[model samples]
Target: MSAGANWAGSHTYSAPAFVEPTSVDELQQIVASTDHVRALGSRHSFNDLADTPGTLIGTSKLPHSVEVIDEDTIAVAPWMKYGEIASALKPLGLALHNLASLPHISVAGAIATGTHGSGDRNSNLANAVAGLTFITADGSIRELQPVDDEFDGAVVSIGALGVLTSVSLDVEPAFEVRQDLWEGLSWDALLANLDTVTAAAYSVSVFTTWVGESAGTVWLKQTVPGRVRGELFDATRAAVDLHPLPEIDASPTTQQRGVPGLWSDRLPHFRMEFTPSNGEEIQTEYLVPRVNAVAALTAVRSLADRIEPLLLISELRTMQADSLWLSGAYDTDCLNIHFTWKRMPAEVAAILPTIEELLLPLGARPHWGKWFAAGHASLKPLYPRFDDFRALALEWDPTGKFRNEYLARTLDLS
Candidate 1:
């Protein structure tokens, strides 16, 4: 019944019993036998959300099935990787709307934490769910549809309500995407032209460091119809070209080449072919209202003097509004601000409070899977449906079988 013997490098709760179920029946059996259980996927979460002292269920081995339910819908197991799903759906001429930073993260895990990508017109991955099936704490499998009131709450349940077994996603026709990577933009110019630059493409992300008031690289992914026939932006033709490759020691030619895959398939913002700078890294991401993005980035920019030497990368991304109750984009467009620290856990911890201080007025919501010193009190105000989600958690999992320290502390689920 048990698989993982130790906790997998989470911020807290280092040791826990982990289990991997091969089938839905086996998963049901485990849930029936274990009073405390939580699903684990890819172990990509920086926080202890997936960590449970009693039993951590690993869905990585769950049966992989992708069924084309209809022209607009596809059903898949929760354990499916975004890459796998994209590959399966490509032939059907369909793909997910957006993806997280990494495609390696499982489908359910990404949806559970409201993982998002860059695009003012696109929402988090969870928003694409037309329906989901979950094994309740009492070992009952229930299917949820968008029409149900609990649907919004369930999409971003964070594995508190139940163990998600399968998901039915609303898909769009597959399209080609051309990436235009640009560098050597001053912070002032980027901020001034942020709207125009972002609107220039379907998805836009700017990566920089807290070191100087300039962007290190800007990646723009523009969706094109019918095989993306022409070049979107020529790095060679840019007036102020500064390649992202040399900064990360990657081949510029390779970095600029467009890969044939779904947008979700290439979720990892960084190119795998490149060797990133070596250092002990810690990540912290927060979502602020879209209107506040400029102000928030400006505030964070002011902290360059304090955050640069100890920081590695800072990314700015956008997300459209979504109905998922706990989604970062709930009710309004969102701008994600991410920080990657270079070693110095203590220093990173120290700067986080200030980061929160600057973002609080902007109504920033911390990424559920990432490290944050803030607890329930601060988070309650950030997410309007925080207590509503807890109520649903109680109703769906009254036995508290899926409850964990993180869930109890952040979601106030007991």
Candidate 2:
């Protein structure tokens, strides 16, 4: 396959070459001989994080096996999509704690970016990782458990340290979920009771155009045998299936209307077989501490007139705190503010600094895989252990074999 644009068509990887190694042994050989290389997962990232100055190694040609480690966990190929992995686990009566908004993203890619699904109690996807195995810059395969001192930094490496090969994630007994859609919660009511609204479901997402005075859509994914249904604060359950983007057709969305189904089928908004979101949008997201969610929203709403014109829609979700060094939710529970903007690069770039300035003081961190104007200097202060992560990256790849424009700019790499 040609090295094409990313899933959002926002970033066309600029690597000199794109190759798919047939096996782990071959993958290692490629890494050992290349001066600089980067692993290309499902190409779901909206930014240039996946691009490399040298060769781009596609993981699809490597092993796609799913090895059952134990009753509580399983090891999966880094290239496998969450939807593909979930299919293998479901038949065996196992399930992951959460999936991202779309399941088409690869296991390694999602974990590297700290991607997440919605839920006040749910942590981002990387938190589910119990162990990781990767090919270091020196061509040595290294295994790391969550207990390792450097494990936290390794989990969300952003392809700075090495090329991840396999990831083991904690799993639970299979469970079912029922997704329901609700609409029209006034902007005031949403900001006032954001926590209560999120806690209403196993996972929930509130979407809006901001041009309107109220939330345009609210999706509630409730685990089977739960009661988070019906009217909620004047937001009534949608009588039919709906897409997060109101203009888009709902057929691509996962089954809804409170019909209970396997977790694999309901947790994600888009069905595995369908393209997610608009497929023509660029994304930007910031995760702020829960304590400042309301204030942050209020601050951003002041820019609604400015934002809505260039925006497609915005989503609000929650994530529990995690210990991963580069994770947006590193030290605090976060409320995610994501914009799926119309593919207008210059316009989005011009507006980002203002958003960052308003939210950064509120303890916001930009999502690693999305578009953001913040460079390493501004981002360094957000993560307390950033210097340590930088030290770790340099220690593993002292020659900077994996370093690229994205890492150089984001990590301030020499």
Candidate 3:
């Protein structure tokens, strides 16, 4: 059987066998017998990160189980989506520290790729992971905890190590959040007060098209009490709910206009019940140290004429430092620049090199699951633990049973 295309239809899997094992014993048998194999999750990746020429194991059919190990930690099925986990925790008065834009993404896929949400004080989703249970190359069960020496290196292994069966995440008391939107702030004021603007809320998102004087919309999700009035550095508070893309409808978005709601409901941009879009776009993202956020934005703005035409929209978000070796925010606070482009793959691919030439010099790290042209030579210097990570992958799977074409091309791991 053939594995289908990804969520955005941008990349199709070429694997000849797609199997969904319903039990851990079956999954282990398949992995042990297959010479080359990989695990597939929610299919949210835009590239070939989860594809292999051999058997592709679909994880969704695995048993859905949740266990509250203690008051502060919860262990869940690796294939469960974030939305499902959040809903399960709410009634018990617990919640994860943050959530990515789409709750529909599977937990194992998101953390393995270093995926994150927005907030100056919030660490990436992988940071919430306290422990992991993996089905390794030999089909033997292995568990890694925070106390392990190689735990940090394994957290974001990009599926080169093994298949994850369970993920233990740290949780906190559930809280309420309110979302507010502001618009029409010029680039001048924004650049000047950028620090103050991002620090104004619990979570912040800045949207733009790179074609106008106005820096575009600022969406804030706050946990503090009371209403926010007046202007945010010359940008006026919006009177109604608005989509990130100005011309599009906001009906599919989460509750806005400063309405108080559960953190699980307001943290994610899109409503869990709705499909955010028709999967008509391609995405690219780069995370740079927060100190260079201003310089990086200025560099991209210089090529606005080139990027504006092929773009659907763009967003800027912030994340706190993390210890995970391969995480974009590793060791320092980061500012991530995201682009949602028109489905013209050729045009988008052609312009990426030019864009990377400018941003890569300013200390930018490309998001693992998104489309990026930078390879091992350009990326090796950005991460301090790059060589260590490669060694870890080799140690975990010496024969390369879990390694695929993407891993070979990007990380040069055999």
Candidate 4:
């Protein structure tokens, strides 16, 4: 009973059992009966974050429901995809603070892995969680709110605590956004005014291949009612829709050319109806502290020739500071340097250590859901609350019912 391969087919699940229980009772029963279990969400992870040897309990079969708790919050089933939740909120005149590059990922999976969208003012997606409910290893349902002492550690549990069932997220009045594109900005200008370029819009993504003299493209998602104009560090505004990868078709991307649309439609880089990014590619990301961003980018730029060969595209985005224990933007604002690479796992894996060697020294933290070379010893010092998070996981799941190989290797929970 194989759990099949991930979205990119980069890794296959070794779990011997895959189960999707339609009801909460069924899910609890399965969780309590199984000695080792892991809740699997949309297979968007580039690594083995969701794998286990005993049972891979999927949340997709669970009911999808959204309850408006108040004007600023909503409690939704964990199985709901960000896109589905966005569609539900749009009609009610509500919207989440931000969304990932693609909305096809499950809400629980995204929160657990500390996924995020780009914005100088917005924190990572996990920060939006106001409350959470999960089935503990003993099959007891537990709920935690922002007031809970362990809430911060539990928000980004990495599926090592329990099987999440409901997630309450902060919401706000719906708004319209317009996406604008800029191209051919020299790296000299970008690195010189990096702060100004990222702060030019509500949300921005700067794309590059690291081999070129000019930055590839800049996608600006700005709140509507006003357009972003004037000096953009001498970068020329694009007249047409464009994809991050210069050679790929732009039809799959969200509305560009400064077209204003609903926040749900413009916040994400891709439309829900179309597949996001290169389906066959792998991804890796590292969050560098705002202070070290320029130095880190310079380090990677130094290895342009090595990275250019296996790269499909690379993006740099910003995130505001957060208090969540394991979040990449925990204490300081961060600049996310992301890579969408050609599916050469062996080649890509071989080159990662070189990149990590350069970036890690400058206080870079790897994205939890993406491909990374650092393990427990290398990762421990990067997070201030790393040991505390392990303690909380142990307290919640005493028998290690939810632990998996990925968690063991990354957190040294074994």
Per-candidate RMSD vs. true structure? 3.6, 1.1, 1.1, 0.9
Give one digit per residue, the lDDT tens place, for model 3 in 1-414. 778899999999999899999998899999999989999989999999899879999987899988999999999998999999998997899989999987999999999999998999998999999999999999999999999999999999899899999999999999889999999878998899888888888889999998789999999899847445456988899998887776778988999998899998999999889887547999999999998999999999999999999998899999999889999998889999999998999999999999999999888999999999999889988899999999999998999999988888778887
Model 1 earns a TM-score of 0.90
- Give the local distance difference test score of model 2: 0.90
Candidate 4: lDDT of 80?
A: 89
Better of 1 and 3 by TM-score: 3
lDDT of each: 0.75, 0.90, 0.91, 0.92
Off by over 4 Å in 4: none
- Ten contiguous residues with the weakest lDDT in model 2: 228-237
At residue 362, candidate 3 shows an lDDT of: 83
Whole-model alpha-carbon lDDT for candidate 3:
0.91
TM, every model: 0.90, 0.98, 0.98, 0.99
Off by more than 4 A, model 3: 226-230
- What's the residue-level lDDT of 352 in candidate 1? 91
**lDDT for model 1, on a 0 to 1 scale?**
0.75
Best by lDDT: 4
Question: What digit string (tens of lDDT, one per residue) describes model 2 on residues 214-331?
Answer: 8678888999898865578878778877888866789998999988999999999999998888978899999999999998898889899999988988999999998999999998
* lDDT per residue (tens digit) for residues 1-414 in model 1: 444322223254443577677889999998878888888876667777877768888777789999988988999998887768877887778878877655667889888999988888988888889999998988988999999978999999888878888899998887767666666567777778777666656777777885564566777676764233233222222333233323554342223444444464344554334333232467789999988888998888878889887777777888998878899889989889988766577888898999899997798899988778788888898888888998898888888888888887887776
Winner on lDDT (2 vs 3): 3
Between candidates 2 and 4, which one is better according to lDDT?
4
Model 2 ranges with Cα > 4 A deviation: none
